[model samples]
Target: MTRRTVVADTRSFRSDIQGLRALAVGLVILAHAGFRTASGGFIGVDVFFVISGFLIIGLLLREAGESGRISILDFYARRARRVIPAATIVLVATAVASAYVLPLVRGAEVIKDSVWAAFFAANIRFSLVETDYFSQGEPPSPVQHYWSLSVEEQFYIVIPLLLLAVAVVVRRRAGEAAEADRVRVLRRTVFVVLAAVTLSSLAWSIHVTATSPTGAYFSTAARAWELGIGGLAATLVWGRAPRLGRWATEAVLAVGLALIAFATLRFDAQTAVPGSAALVPVLGSALMLAAGSTTGASSTYLFRLFSIAPARVVGDWSYSLYLWHFPVLRLCEEYWEEPRLSKPHLAVALVLIFALSAASYHLVEQPFRKGVRWRPRLRAITLYPVSLAMVVVTAVGAHAWVDGQIAALEDNPGIAVSDYGRDGLSKDPTVALVEASVLAAQDDRPVPGGLEPALGSVRESVAPLGDCDYRTGTRKLCAFGDPDAERTIALMGDSHARHWSPAIDAIGREHGYRVYVFVYSGCPAITFTRLTDGGRPWTECADFKEWALGQVRELHPDLVVLANNAYQSAAMKKRQVGALRDQLELLRPLAGKVAMIGDSPKLPKAPGTCISERDVDLGDCLQEPETGPTRIQGQFRQTVEDLGMTWVDARRWFCAEDRCPAVIGNVVPLRDREHVTVEYSTLLADPIAAALGIAEG
Candidate 1:
């Protein structure tokens, strides 16, 4: 193997950049720790992206300038050694710890997440999960923060190949040219490529952020421009960095810091990320990096402040700190009932994070990083495969543990139908089964066997919408149950309405009514909608609704049923009521009849999660009718009834004696906190049929 040398020695370390790392990690930790003021602390990852691009690109350019070629093998070797060691340890540890701490269902999810994180595809996995409507309400994975690392690792791969491509093109164009000429051409070509990536990705990021913010948030394509901007800065500063005066440097640093501070303070989770808003922090980080690379900048007070010993120390441990803090905070938050940790709990988490990070830095990160330095052989690159294998083995072990638990539970005796009859709970079998389960729960009896969909897979038992359930404005007509029937029934709403599809389809089949289903994620079918949850114009949902309503009109459905989440917005109360009225009035002319399916009760804890716990009191999974959200839903029911449309009270299907159980008729009711599972919904077909006055076949 050919040997190559780095252009700069280790002493060229920029304490200012190190301080910047400290700042970035600090912001992330503060945000995760629930510091309300630092709601936009997520910009810290943007800072890190810029820093990584500047340092890595600058190093590669210097090596290319010196040797007339860049060594892809050596570059990858360093990256593998620097990142893979600490990352592997964290991934494996988080997976093992999750299996012990989380319930079987959630723990299995974490194990799968760990595998994705280990292979640096966690962002893709998470984006897929987020796009799945059923997984919307699931808790964040312990290794969720690895998504950023995955982005960086992906950058590491693409950048080297990109630079090599630039080198190849420069050599072909400037054949037999002097080394200086070749270097100059390489630099210019690299700059153009970097600029194009930055601009094109920025435009795409803005578009995606508007249309699909969750997808944009985790997308490498959307985030690449941030790193590209940093690369552009590095390209400009290489071999010809400005020698700015102290005052100029201070002014630049001050402006950069101000921009970052403004974004950190003013932005919140609702901010459209990696979009136009992201320019604030990305540019801020780029400016600071550019200024710091100048000759006289280090003498500036602002520079010295960032170069302080404490900041430098924090920066040294920043990588390990970033890796450990999220899982530590997430697992700790799991034990706490509140959405955000209390100050005392946060303090404890910080202590644990710092301690674990310090240990990881000294014990794992330092050893591997230094080992690579002492043994700079091409064989060190093999660490990539080895590290991945270690993580995979750990994930496999965790999966085995989860599968073992499922098999054991499967062997236990199941709750018999005889129990329902012996209990004499209700004449209706479904109602009776639910009542019996509730009684068994109240008595603190062991979790019975033969639970439908099983707790381990219950989270995934959502009503299957095939390809028709749109997450965006795009519409696809999906018909069920006697698609050729003359009498058509239109079922329309957001995911809340979707949960009732199984029962409605079953009823439609029995009654010879073709069901046309139109369900969009987070989109309420009611007219007069104006804004999305992020306060942007809800053009997509509005267009979808118009298109769906037009289709319903064309079909001339016999009955049009509209349903959505019943959880009331204190502010949108009047608007929601008015919208429903307008929706009914509009649909009255489009169909023979209009009906509204009342919202089902929302559980405090997700039934899938609640039932997974050892000896969990199933009664705790039940919700009362008078809960705030349920009361609000009831108010909406009254409004619907007052509008002279048949209102199917769906609460009656799930609730018995004013109490709604999470599991009914041996099936998990809600997949998450609100949407009912397909199995439970199927069991409600009889009640739904009676409610709609559709005589069974």
Candidate 2:
């Protein structure tokens, strides 16, 4: 292959830009490390978006100006060199680490995520999965941070072609005109496009953020305006020299820094983001960029400080730092079982992050960008195919492994369902505890075949079919057990209610009852409105619940079972209790017997991981259950009694003496933190049936 020198463009280079990069990465690091003061530090991503727009668009404009046409191949090749190598390294490392440290189920998810990240489509994958960015209970994926990189990659793919199309249009319109006239037309076209994109996307951002903040955070359309703002600035100042005086430059820089600081300190998880709030950091970044472009501003003290070696060094490693930090933090939390890092732990994590980032930047990023000489075609042929092959192999292997485990478990049906031999209303916790101890004793023995991975296939065994689960405005009713039975039983609520499907289905099948399930993921069968974890009004959830209530009334089931994971706003005890009471009152008229099923005890982490990891002690995995009735349970129980209904506490099945064990009878009791594993749920059929005052068939 022939070599070509892609020399630096000194005129476009701004030393102070590196300082902005440092500041942005620093804020993100602080936020992820759990710094209370830097609540809005997530805004650093908006700043980076603006900087990326300014720099990339400026490069495109320069290429068009000097060469009289832009080279799409060359642009993409540069992008590949800058992004692919280090990212691939991180993805591979993360996959290997995840498989070793996390549970097989979670490890499988990370493997899939790594594959998506490798293709620069992680944002699409995350959006499809509906991964909530602000969820505290869910385990953080090692590659979750790749969503931002995916957005940037998607932008790079489109923007170049967009600019080239504009150039073609300008050339056609200015046929036989002077080169200067053609340039003027092109600049005007660029400005119009950027301004239009900025306004439209900003409007979309505000609307989406208000309606579905989780979706808004990941959607490219909602985020395009942040990048477009930078593109607009670049277009307006194309081929021009800054004319700001020394004091004016200082004032602008000071104001820009102040705006960034204000956002970093003031914004928290509850604050609506990437909407109007994002303007603070976006405009601040643009102001700094404008100030940096001034020719003599380098002499100013503020500018000089920003251009210092340390800031530039940090800026150079910013991309790698951003990639490494979150994974390291997540791994630390996973291993140590401590989500909140102490000062000493935070310091150690930072040191490790910086070291990893520095090595990655020097070894993978810089060498690929500066030393490698492969043409775009060669790189695409070699790099993409290899990366794709790695992804396919890993994903296939993971799926097969999990599938094999599930198949093995299917062969041994007795392991999951054999322990439910008890009869009547038994209050003895030792019955379940003794059974679980017998199961635990089997943990040390090697079986004829390897042990079946229960947690990995927990959801698939009992979850309502995906297409039948009601979401959004749609209403879906899944019927289990004897459809023509005289006695009808209805299961209603969110995922917490759905987790009980296995148990209810077993009871219905055995006792000649038809079971109807009306459940969604986040929606509870309650009267009061609730917001999503991201702080957006859960309007779809409200609509679904209304539809479900109507279905329950129409069906008029002999018995109605109400359950939900009421963990949100634990501090707001009174509100939660009142909501449950209102819900019970509504359900009373719908069924002959209304029963309030108290939530199962929540574990600190997924029981599967705790059981899988040899280093984790079984005792540490157990959680101290509530000593007294939860406010919601107590209030709902009182209301049920007053209405002459029933209250069944399910915690007795999972917990003994106010302490919940992670595993029972070779079964991982909880799937995630709160939902019971399907195997465990199936075992609870007898107890649940007795709670509803049903006689055995």
Candidate 3:
């Protein structure tokens, strides 16, 4: 295709759309910056999806309408020019900043995330990792915002091919003389296709949001409907939307703005989102776009306001602003060790964000878009191969570097067992002795060679045995520690219980007892009903708990060890305590002895990410362990004591008299915010066995 043929649609400025961009970006910034009123400002991303669909689909339809065919190469080249340059600059810069500001272990993960973002596959990577977008304990990735961009890029890739196919079929049927009829047929066909996709995607969004809200948030399938809604609008009424009277335009604009405002102010992280709730913002945005398109120059005051220079200027910088805000906010949070910013600090950060956005928009984004000629021949000859090579090289290099670091750590035996206090183990172990050893080894500096090597090895040490580990639905029994042994000790509960397996299994092996691992992800061992994060009944957990109770009775295990991370809302504390009482009462009659381990200290942040060798002091990363018994722990102890069962308070092993150190005896204590590292868990074997009345071998 010639340059003239490909460039059939000239770019025209739309002040209203630009204003919408500004509003969307502003809401997102406010929301991310911890403004209480903008809790639902995250919906701004949904607004962007609609706007993108409208603009991109409009261009393709216009091109096909004029030339009777779409230039695939030219379309891709235009996308590359518009998206890649600024994204690359931001990705590289974020990677460099992460290495300096973040812990080495976390920095390695960010590098991987940056590589995924560079290839516009960050959404897929995040989904694979099951990263919780709303999690508070885990530090957010600097490039987490790239997930939406990835979804949009994926849409761009698919939509053009679909439009081209529709155009081909329309032309083949109608012939050259009936070009107008062919274009009309293509429009109708496109509208029908978009409508179907919209409904299908909406259904999927609702279903997925109900079943798995976190997954739904990052899912392309769940988000596609929003874009399809915009595509439908473009196909049906690009330039020919019916003109509306001033009164009607004003009403539409008023209602649209109100809906968006309600959603922005009312919705929060706990709100079910990307489902029916998302329709508030999506439909509101569509209404605003429709009204803006139909309103005349002398129409409504709202239309005039949106067309003003200030909104347009912000709109011009909106893309860069959105790109810059999250990373800047994340950096600020990392430095301060706080999620919320003070007013003065927030104001300064916003100023910095705007300055950086302006520089990126002018120096990187606008320059590349204008200079890069999107001619079909040039793009096919140069851009595609070069872009693909950059993506491949970045991803491969990052993966290789992380792998090498992990491998070096794994090969060094000294690093694995360093400062473990193995010599301190005694026949009669106590929490006080464990604390003494840890406190004795405590140092201001981070572990030697940083914590990445230890953090990387953590998973391997605690990972459930092969295929025997139960991940979903019901429980699967995984046996360890001399399976042929007559005396069986059962370890039960969710991942909190699973974290203690390294020590428990070691104890079982030494004692000539078989250890049966029966744990599920996120499912606690409780008698009362519980809900998943998505607000559905945790049926699998209930089912597994019931089944395990029966199995324990049948097997007549010599000992049953129970544990759970019972940190929950104050409202549920009473019910959770009651449930613990009920579970303990039931277990008392089934096993020879039932022991309940108290929950570990829930750290303010992931220890791996919080502790670094570069820091002058540990700072707020070291928190004082709660002096009094936790409400749940107190309840558990009371319930177990009432049932005449064993109750082990293991908190002293994790925290000392004043503070809980992130690293104890050259070992990072936590794999994440809540789970203890296997190396540390192994250190607790003697103390735990002592608590269980198990004598040393």
Winning model by TM-score: 1
Model 3 segments beyond 4 Å from truth?
A: 1-12, 174-177, 295-298, 336-338, 372-433, 441-465, 468-489, 505-516, 532-559, 588-593, 617-622, 626-629, 686-690, 693-697
lDDT of 3 by residue, 166-219 (tens): 888877777865766777788888888779889999999988887667778888
lDDT of 1 at 517: 87
State the weakest 10-residue window (summed lDDT) of model 3. 1-10
> Candidate 2: where are CA atoms >4 Å away?
1-10, 65-69, 103-105, 128-130, 333-338, 342-345, 375-377, 390-453, 458-462, 476-489, 505-516, 532-537, 568-572, 615-620, 626-631, 693-697
Per-residue error (Å), model 1, residue 465: 2.3
Candidate with the larger TM-score of 1 and 2: 1
TM-score of decoy 1: 0.92
lDDT of 2 by residue, 451-538 (tens): 2235555433445544566754445666787777988999888888988988888989989999988887766777766775446677
Off by over 4 Å in 1: 1-11, 131-138, 176-178, 336-339, 372-378, 406-427, 472-474, 567-571
Model 2, residue 358: distance off in Å is 2.2
Our model 1 lands, by Cα RMSD against the true structure, at 3.4
lDDT values, one for every candidate:
0.79, 0.74, 0.74
* Cα error of candidate 2 at position 679, Å: 3.2
